[model samples]
Target: MQTSSTLTPPAIRHDEWALSDVHGQYSDANSHADLYRFLMRWIDVSTHLNIGYSRFGQRHLTNANFTRLIDRIARPMLELYDDSVHRHDRRLLDIGSGRGGAAIHAHQSYGLEVLGIDITPYNVERANANARRRGVWPAVSFAEGDAQDLPIPEESRALVWSIESPAHFPDKKKFLHEVYRVLKPGGVFAFSDLLAVPTRVRQWPEFYKEFLRVWDVPYLETMETYSEALWELGFDLRKTEIVTKNNIDIYTGYARRYLTYFRIPGFYKWYTGRVRRRWGANLDNVREHLRHSYNALSRGTIDYGLFWAIKR
Candidate 1:
């Protein structure tokens, strides 16, 4: 995960998001397609992008039940999906679907048709190839689109889920409105994202600010903001789960291990050499990003939240 944050450091208020602030190596390089590919090239799965979940007594980075544990993280969201009710149009819309890991998993595990929309065209192409490789091409497909303004039609989808992608979204409230606009009357919507603990975040810039800068995250919306928006947008919030205990420390530990390993000059060269020269992301930036992600998460400045609701 050689992620380079484009956000300027010394962030006075990382949570205060603005449209103009999306610059530099953030989405600019991603507009060229190669940035996303280059940044996440080392990840094991071509279709995987999200930092997966880990449970109690389970080592997240080296868990014997890694796949099952990841699936368990999504179980809360999946519970809101009524397979019977979604029979009319069974396509599960995955917004901000990076490389289609969650999308393919949905089709493979639940036998449902899935449509994944991502902002990066390269990822869309790569995700499609991955689906074909898994023999789920037609059943699971990827397209390039924005979450704030979906290309999908209004009131057409029965189920929508986003996994750990909304943190990068500049306008989470607008994204939620778009979700509400697209789903059927009783459509189920679910997502997992980094949520802010306002006071904690304000108190820990040393750990959290670097995380915002390295990850190129605009800002995180709080549980209050999102839950209130859900009701105001006409959705009945079925559940809100804070799973920091199971996830943050695990991912943080993974980064700590990588940071340690990267300290070895031989290993650093090996990893850097692997990156394409044209789209080379600063390895230092990636390390800083990864380090702070875990640090901030483990310290409680930020949290991982899963929210699922039904359209009223």
Candidate 2:
């Protein structure tokens, strides 16, 4: 990744809130509730908490179908198994499950029992409500828990799924170990996340550092690092692929939506006011971080990856 020194850095208004503080805020129920409410109102109607993937390439996607694209990203994980067996016996664990979208989809589409866990209690409650609304309440349940320290029992889940969520984890290694611990032997752990290209990170240190602060992640590991970690943790690294184009498409779609939303009368004012009130001085930092992320994605300083591994 080429570093552009010509780009002007945004002013940092909030010096008190460090990366650790931001991470804590995410786990704070009240804080995350406010954030989720804002996102639901402004981002997408379908309650997707992550970037949606686009298949027809970046040129053809619109905000209207962006939510559907999110579901599409999860389809491959669901299709990994044969659903011919008894549905009640098949358990799928969704780590960092947001609003139960993927959980409900798995239950309704594949007849699998889904257990969705999130760090925020409010998100867990919202997920349960969404599950009830989707009529998959009993089959799909949500709990408040951390991905790094899962509440699940050993050999409890047949499949552990995470969608664009591990990037938020402060410790990816511990989370991967937890996933391996909870999954049954021969079970699969599948996920998608933003990754830093090792070569690019070395070249663009400033951009990479800003990305960590903005993204609320401690560090972004390359695909090679992930494979090595998984292999060392007794996982059979089945698949790992770079999907940077899809990530670019998703960010582009979101940018379009943000612009459209800004055009709405008083929408930006109201949204910004709410965020500032809730987050205080950190608001400007948040905005700057997002700007940095968009630019980084466009420049290919970062990449999106999809990975699947079976517990050995």
Candidate 3:
């Protein structure tokens, strides 16, 4: 169902959590620390998992799955305009950069200056540690800050990137505006995230609610809606596309892993009853609702979107 109108309740006290904690919970389904290590190294999902691979109906994503996803999603943008050519001597900021993986990749591979920002202290600490270990400490650093009000100088960044992070912002518009304000002219702001589906499925409200619960996200947006905001914010609409389930291999692979590795009879139950219980209220309704959500995706009712944009 479409995320734009879902309108989940705003996050409140105790709803706040560290990024590491969120990672730790999700990490339970897949025991892949190397995946985390890999993601931090590349700063992109593609560095962690191969999206081309799949098992069952779900995209089986190892840490490597993230890498592959990023690789595929970013191909169009990079093809249109390889900002790195001009950014070798410039600075890049990765908003909500989890564990600084892509930041590390940019610094080590392309030798571009990079800065990562996130609200989670654990992510900031871990990212810094990883950068130091990679010998990019001086060139790549992670900072603690809010996404909506980044502590960066105006017109200082040549490239801004986010991987599956903008949806976490309470006000996506504010998040975009902030990034726009900081970007220099002709700079690029590229990202890949779980966008809202185009239509709302009233029957799947529970599934929708659980989606919000699992991620603590107040809202999600369709790529179309986000594109409109980007346009209004002065971002030149370069290329926007949906990473259609044409490649379900990635998801199926993840499904197989869950069933084979974790022996989880049902991934939804394990996630909601086990992972979400820590938050409170073992809502059976939510659990069942999420099960349906899984079914919907498994049956091709929902889709993921990948978007790319640039500032004029």
Candidate 4:
């Protein structure tokens, strides 16, 4: 394990005016609003921003168990660089880090010094506050930055990771290059995200296209395409695993929970009315898209992919 003394303090950029602008934009975007965060926390009060992992053979898991599984998936990336020679250099850069859960988990579990960055300043603020409340403060820090243009210096990180965030990147290739630039030689880059099976994408129903549009994801790269891009950027591919089954199970569980939660008298009316008023027709579109996304997973039109590679 790496001791804190060997780790350099994370450089956090502060642009107060820009942060205020981002906060206003983020609040206006319903998907990124505090209510959404509240709903997510309602689903799982634990430290996580991902859909629950279902590898335990249960369609649904307790919040704690689900968060534990999320951490379990990240453990292998840490283990890959655990040799004695590299043990003292465990610095991590988490791109698109939401609420700092994954960063905090990595710090607590592996003693990795983590710096998390997200485009949303509100998320960064909340994540930093979470780190302080959890007593991890300086060991795990959060900042606001775009993934495509990482704020860190070149070759500064021993590991770069993201969770379920690549699909949201408008220019994934640019982000890949940035990841390569920031990682030390032999450093690992690990991530998990939604992928499109090219063959199935062309065959997708109209509803699926609507789902993609509503979700703000123009397109997704297949696992093969993603790996090829990594290779082109000079990363040595180490592992790629399809975890679509777990994603499907997770969505199914969420749908079930949504229905059950809605059954509570005034809650459904209040929530739905609020969404309808705020987002208008987009509310129905978003809900329909969620359903379609789950179906797309079951039909193999979309997949969840976990990948790991080394900067070589």
Q: Where is model 2 more than 4 Å wrong at Cα? A: 1-46, 57-75, 83-88, 249-289
Those runs of model 4 whose alpha carbons end farther than 4 Å from true positions after fitting are 1-28, 31-38, 45-47, 59-61, 256-286
Q: lDDT by residue for model 1 over 257-281, one digit each (tens)?
A: 8788888999898777665464466
Candidate 2: 10-residue stretch with minimal lDDT? 5-14
How close to the true structure is residue 303 of candidate 4, measured as C-alpha lDDT? 76
Question: Candidate 2 clashing pairs?
Answer: none
TM-score, candidate 1, is 0.79
Task: Please list the Cα RMSD from the true structure of every candidate, rounded to 1 decimal place.
Answer: 6.7, 6.7, 7.5, 9.7
Of candidates 4 and 1, the better by lDDT = 1
Residues 26-122 of candidate 4 have per-residue lDDT tens digits of 4445442333434443454324556656665664545654555456567677667674245578788899887788888788877888999999777
lDDT of candidate 4 at residue 128, scale 0 to 100: 90
**lDDT against the true structure, each candidate:** 0.72, 0.66, 0.60, 0.68
Model 3, span 1-104: residue lDDT tens: 54645443222212443445445533422222333332233334322222332224543334544445556554665554465344443576878876677777
Model 4 worst lDDT run, 10 consecutive residues: 6-15
Query: lDDT tens string, model 2, 1-312?
Result: 424321212222123334444434454432322433444434542445666665654433344344454455555655554442322357888898876777787777677788998886756887898888878887899998889999888887778888878877767889999999998777777888877765656566666666565555666666766777899999988778786666555664565466557567687678678766754423334345456665555456678888877788
| Candidate 4 pairs with clashing backbones | none
The true-structure Cα RMSD of candidate 1 reads 6.7
- Stretches off by above 4 angstroms in model 3 are 1-61, 73-88, 244-249, 256-296, 299-302
Query: After TM-score superposition, what is the CA distance of residue 136 in candidate 3 from its true location, in Å?
Result: 1.6
